[model samples]
Target: MSAHTWGSLDDASARALMEEALAAATGEGVTFADVRLVEAEEERLYTDLRGELDERREHNAGLGVRVLRNGIWGFASAPVDGAGSAAAVARRAVAVAGASTGTAPVRLAPREPTSGTWSVPVDVDPFEVPAGERHDLLQRIVTAASAPGLVRSVTAGLNAKRQHKHYADSEGSRQSQHLVESGAMLLAVAADERGAQRRSFPNSFHGNTAAAGWEYVLGLGLEDEATRVGEEAVALLGAPQAPGGTADVVIGPAQLALQIHESVGHALELDRILGDETNYAGRSWVQPEDIGTLRYGSPAMTIAADPTMPGTRGSFAFDDEGTPASRHLLVEDGILRDVLSSRDAVARHGGGAGSGSDWPGAARADGWAWLPVCFATNVYLEPGEGSLDELLDRMGDGYYADDNRTWSIDDRRMAFQFGTEAAWEVKNGKRGRLLRGFSYGGLTPQFWGSLEAVAGPEEFKAYGMPCGKGEPKQWGFLGHGASPSLFRGLSTGVAR
Candidate 1:
């Protein structure tokens, strides 16, 4: 990390501005108000086999204010100009609140006011590195994966971001946070008359992002893995197709993470369950009455949402709403226990989100310009006993799959299909020939209900990616953790 220290809102000018906005909004007879001052930067670097490079960068600094007036909420945001900008935004927020007249008043679940500051610990700040060095890293992965004849093409890229935020609310909560995240990926495509096949290291989307730094990128070791990625892309071209039928299967961590994300994470958001997202993102199949009663999976299944886990993409000291970080079980022993809840959603449900004190601190916004919404953080299936090999042995005969390629789910986050980039045939408890075009489908509850085994903690791994939701479209960083797991009697098919 550089010798530079990140600025905090407690500094003179920022604190003054935040107080000014709060005073302005509360003066207008609003019951609640909060202001967020944010400064952020994002960098993306891309390269391909031919030694060409492309780069993109974005920087934003702004203040957004949210207010509750006459029981309805209103929001307004603007670029931070000076001392007067915050008060102006606050007044505008109140005016916006006046425009909404007929909706029922909103209520927030009670939470203790918290004051503190936190940041992701990093060995090296990615932004301090030179642009040329970043480009070289991407080029190295592309070069390592290139085989002029068999591997026809290679693409690699890196992403780095840093954001400093200060939040203050009328309820006396004050906090500041500095976060940095970075990651990279490599892809190889091999093609001939038989058609094209591809493989990705880490993941297919954005490879393993986390609330870390340049050290996280180094840990990916993309250059060292590139050769294997290239070889796999070539081998896949000649692999036999996966057969179609109801079958037992073993899912590796890489693919299981995605399954957990799409089917369980989104399906359990409290806002989606309350029908607030129905016009945009579809409502959840889970109803408000389902908590603590619905049999969501097998007795062996358990899932938790935790934003306090260190170094995860979703790990934060406090959510955008100023709620302190929390960990809670969304499902326990196959029963639905809680959903991803916001303060307002929890109160709307009459505090039915979680038993006792779990606040479900899952509300977050994409940036300063958007409104905070209920979103998934680190959602994961709790690991069970046994190694991956042992879990496969228990399966006896099945397909072993990893690396997500394609996914399709209904709007309700139910009844879905997912295709993986590679698979292996398991015969008599031993992995045999390679198989390609592996796909599977099942309803959400039914899919999890079939869970037969989960590898122990040693096999557990967390994967991160961007998940898009909401009407104006905010992409939230989501993390999913899982071990190699076994599922029984899934509807399997050949994708290609």
Candidate 2:
């Protein structure tokens, strides 16, 4: 075997040595082989008036392999330290594959050999920010949250990660890529005579994670959001517990995007339909039989998976399995158009192709990382041709809700509940008093189907968010763009 220094795996000479060892596996009569390595560093900061409880960084990497003979899938993985261990690990994977045959064959659908690497774009790395600045930033938010009748506390922190991957299948295809991501989250807790209330604001720093630096925290600007959230808690202590009655509620981007994510997004994943993901995140209420004909929402409703959207957590040029990122229509004019698909799912559906699911992974001559699953990068609701004021004028009297506080849904993606953190009462075509604990409870179809209007881009904005799925747990960066949308004759009187 000969060595080829494909690329720097985070400045380690070991990367070249591992590549040669994986190359050795190619001649070993194995059915398949590829190589991947992950080297990551992370830091976190937490604060209150008392001080910082956490500040830390860590890294890990490994080579994983998969093989098949006589219908079974086998895998073996270990941390990659040098060239000798790399070749040894590949043999172990072949053994695991043979052992696995007692059950069913690990038959993977065929995919064109893929070869390439992609690096998420970034201007500044988050790790560059000093510890002092980080704490000072969080303290400001806590200070602002102090208000009468309210107890205030602020929690702010950042997470950064850089991943390097290399892949070479049994086919001639060979490729490598580097992806980095970082993000900040601010959690503020408030309480008054009524009860304890909590809300969080998060911002994911797109593809390049830890690279964003400390300056990113200033962008989160907890000081700006804390007071508003704290004020909401105090107001709720005095406001009527969101009188449960039939009245239209204006759901802002935060709440609506989550509704679309949990209901429409997850329902369209083919694995759920094939009965592979029912134990945890619930299966789809909508199915293949419903595509194109399922009246999922109002005729005005349209939604899409947008990997190219800037500053989105889910944005990627190429997925772990080397599939190209793309924008695909999941819904058009309230009709289901497509499901997120993996190489496996795409083939199972009689050669129906995939646009590349979000969280899938591939084998590296060491251990197996998860194949990316279907997920949203920058998901946006197509805006309607109406202004917020115009929509309100049309509504007569109601309230507007913003950002999610509480979310719940049944296993089948239908019948759900949600509570918003910010709200303003609208009366007679104008904004009225501020209110809290605004919840809209209903089935997925009815909620979207009632859509009367959506605010345009001027009203559209992003939710710095975390969208999660899968067992053994994989969390993906997600963006949801929506404007304040209005629904008529809504039922908002639920108590939680």
Candidate 3:
């Protein structure tokens, strides 16, 4: 983490940025206003077989202003420090509200003020290390993947993070936060006389806490895993295609968590359904009337949004608006018990209490951090009965998919399809050789309803990267809490 990215800011500087933003917004005369300062350093190391840096690291900090007036909203943002612009933003938002007139209704749930400064904990800094180490590591992995008719190209990537945030709200919520995250991605591209195929084993670890430093990157012994996975990819080039049918699936944590993130994550968002994000990200299928009544998944499904999980990408002691973070249920017993909501969503829903801080880029933080936008924190789907082996044995003949490629679902979160990097055929209750061009698709509710069993925590692990949502594109780090689990009647086919 030695290479200076956006995570390079001093805490005091960040704090001052927030204090200035809060003072600017409310002072301008608006019903409600918030600011978020997001400082992030994102490093990308893309290497070919020889392991050369295709793209250097990138990082930035930006301020965003979201304001509400007379039941309407407006937003403005720029990279430069627009400290005093909050007043203009507030007024502009009011103008927008007036222009819209009878369009979308406005509402917000009351929230308790939350304030604090938080940072991730770590021992090794990713930027501090030289880029040469990562480059050399990639080369080694690629070289090892070389063998008979098996491998073609290896593109390895290292993603390191340094996030510093400052938040302050009109309601007296003030916070300064810092966190770190690091990840590795290795795509093993292969070829046969037939065609070309690609698979990847991606992993993210270290810096999942509320406080951190350089130590996070060094902690992940990536070199060993690279060699192992690269070799496996070479072998998988000769693997078979997954059979298409209603086969039961035993999924590892990586694939299972992503399913949770896609189907459950987006559908539970309050703003998506309200059409606030329609012009930008798209709306959700879940409606206001569907809350607590829609049966989203199986009776075993118990999902939650928790921001206090410490070093996770989405974990926050207090949200950007100074609303304290909390764990809220999104689904329970196969029913849509709740959807992730911002303070305004809570108000609109007129249900119960909500941490207004749950908003993405939630405003009231430093440097135009952001106002409330719906996002998942840490999502945990309750484990099912039986062990990974038991579930696998029960499957008979199916495919085992790992890691995800491209994925798509309707705005309503109904039918969906995902491309996997690697897989194997589970024939007659046993694991088989690696496979290529693995594909799986299913509907949201039926997929979860088929949940036969979930692996214990020993088999559970965090997947790679953070989840993304919203128009104007606010991406927050979030995780899915799911163990290796099994599902029945999963669909598969060739991807176009």
Candidate 2's displacement at residue 312, Å, is 0.8
Indicate whether candidate 1 or candidate 3 has the larger lDDT. 1
lDDT of 1 at 347: 85
Off by over 4 Å in 2: 1-8, 11-32, 102-110, 147-149, 202-216, 351-377
**What is the RMSD, in Å, between candidate 2 and the native fold over all Cα?**
4.8
Q: Write the per-residue lDDT of candidate 1 for residues 1-496, one digit (tens) a residue.
A: 6312653333456678888888889644488999998878888888897888888989887889999998889999998877689999999999999887746898888888898988889898888888878887787788778854689989898888888888999999998888898888788999988888889988887677888889888887788898789888999999998999999999999998899988999999988988988999798899889987999999889998888998888888888899888888889989998888788888888745453345777888888898999889889999999888898889999989999999999889988999999999998888998888999998999999999888899999888888888889998887898999999999999444
Measured by lDDT, the strongest candidate is 1
Q: Can you give the lDDT of residue 464 in candidate 3? A: 37
> Per-candidate RMSD vs. true structure?
1.7, 4.8, 4.2
Please count the clashing residue pairs in each candidate, in the order shown.
0, 33, 49
Give all candidates' CA lDDT scores: 0.86, 0.62, 0.63
What is the TM-score of candidate 2?
0.85
User: Which portions of model 1 show Cα errors greater than 4 Å?
Assistant: 2-12, 355-357, 494-496
Highest TM-score, which number? 1
Cα error of candidate 3 at position 437, Å: 3.5
